[model samples]
Target: MTDTATDRSTDPQKAPSTPPQGGQGVMARIRSYTPTLRVQRVLAMLLLIAQGGITVTGSIVRVTGSGLGCNTWPNCHDGSLVPVAGAAPMIQQIIEFGNRLLTFVVAAAALLVFIAMVKAGRRAELKTLAFVSGIGVIVQAVIGGMSVLLDLQWWAVAIHFLPSMILVWIAAILYTRIAQPDDGTATRQFPDLIRILAFVAAVCLAAVLVTGTMVTGSGPHSGDAGVGMEGRLEVDTRIMTYIHAAAMYIYLGFTLVVAFLLHRVKAGDAAKRTAWVLLAMIVVQWAIGLTQFYLGVPRWTVPAHIAMSSVVVAFSAFLYAHGRVREGGTGTSPTGSPVGDARLAASRA
Candidate 1:
């Protein structure tokens, strides 16, 4: 006999199974889980920190002369995912392999931030920033693998490092944007002249970084001991160092000008504070650069320099972001009216 509805409900074997929500299963669940703004901001902040942190680890691999510790790309010691016995010095293998492993950690952080942005229904700008960050991590990994396959060529290594800075820039912007309300209007915190100066400062910073890479390519650290001077850039280290130093001075000057303008314009306290912090970091970075020059680039200074570069980049991005803010519903209107009060008066009228 056919099972009746009551019998089916009572019989375990005959009971009708409930289909997954909307029949979309995991994807539906993922779509349903919305992250709070605070959670999203935390994820973004973590991504920013991870982007900066990996550069330090990469510097460790370079300074340790362990770039080719595993001696292969997409595998450690060839035909293996981890370090192989006697493939290289155990420490070198571990260092290089460990650095490679960190790529995943950074990528995981990027993924989490990306998911947070999407789940929170954040604005397009935030979404794009998160998306680019994830993509940037993958690009960095590919470039890293290519650098390994190319035997850690100077240019290849530079190519690998620069994207990381770009990713850091993106992550910084993402962190800044995540804190802004989705429904908000753009508010300029400073005058257009100051904004232009900030733009020039950013350009100078880019030059400083690019020239700095050139200096590195001409330096003693070729990422691997075996690489030596074979594939190193042919430029004279002294001349490249001078050029890098010049670019840095110009960047520092422009940053100082920006800070001056911020004070002159009586900008928001946050903008002024960011400008001050950026100025301080630039000074510290300049001192580190001088120490590297005078001390002949000590091994310990490489990572310190690299870490400070990341910090400087993040703060530079932050200072620029502070130039423009998104004014939310509760924020002041461009005409100096209280946003909520203006709406209230309009409604009353």
Candidate 2:
């Protein structure tokens, strides 16, 4: 037996004296840096950043009147992969090319997220999020192409902006979900007043988005002269725009109230952080809106206004995700379904 042991020890490829269980072997070698739930969260956050970048770039294209620079969808001018050689001007080419490059980047990021989700295996919710984001990226690309092909019609532009905002929100929710481990208990709870404030804030944000679309549609920046029949702002348009602006002030007030409530309840660090972010975003957004209007819609201000709206939307989504019923129920998910209710109840107790 001693001689045999010596012979076995001489073979480098031979199994060790005690082989590990399959699961143990896998677990033992699992490095911390290996793809994990955290990686998925990071990827989701990156994808959101990319989405936000695309929105900003698209705004640049609009503000610069570069929407028509390429003059076609899925291709630049003259049917070339790059912009037309010396076509028009270099600035036009740069802006249009930059926008196109961003689209490709977003698509690539989405694909990476999909792969990460698949590798995550047992995380169903995360996998679903990745799937939704991937689908959203594809649909967004198609709609973007349609916008270009249709010469950036007002409705197309509105839908494009809206869906991208929604995608960002989805990404934000996924990030929060994955970043926090699902302890058997859920700690999300808030008073009735806080719930009402969150609801009002969300409604106000949506109203702001819709009305901003109308305002853009009515403005020269929309790139579509056909929006408002006969170039006249309809009563509906006026009403929506006013409501949208009014909603902004309402949102600002509600957010302040939320900040106060958050302070009163001593909500956890997460909720408090969210409240602060919401407050900052609300203040900045209001200031930007005023500046944009007073500045008479300057090209630079247009993108600023748009960027602020995106921030507000993201914050609103964060608030909604973190909101839990005080009676120990999970707040409604984006699709209006309850999640983590049982866990929340246990935590409340």
Total backbone collisions, model 1: 0
Clashes of each: 0, 0
Location of the lowest summed lDDT over 10 successive residues in candidate 2: 328-337
lDDT of prediction 2 = 0.70
lDDT (0 to 1) per candidate: 0.85, 0.70
For residues 195-256, what per-residue lDDT tens digits would candidate 1 score against the true structure? 88998999999999999999999999998898888889999999999999999999999999
lDDT of 1: 0.85
In the predicted model 2, the residue pairs found to clash are none
- In model 1, which regions exceed 4 Å deviation? 1-31, 330-349
| Prediction 1 TM-score vs. true | 0.87
Cα error of candidate 1 at position 266, Å: 0.8
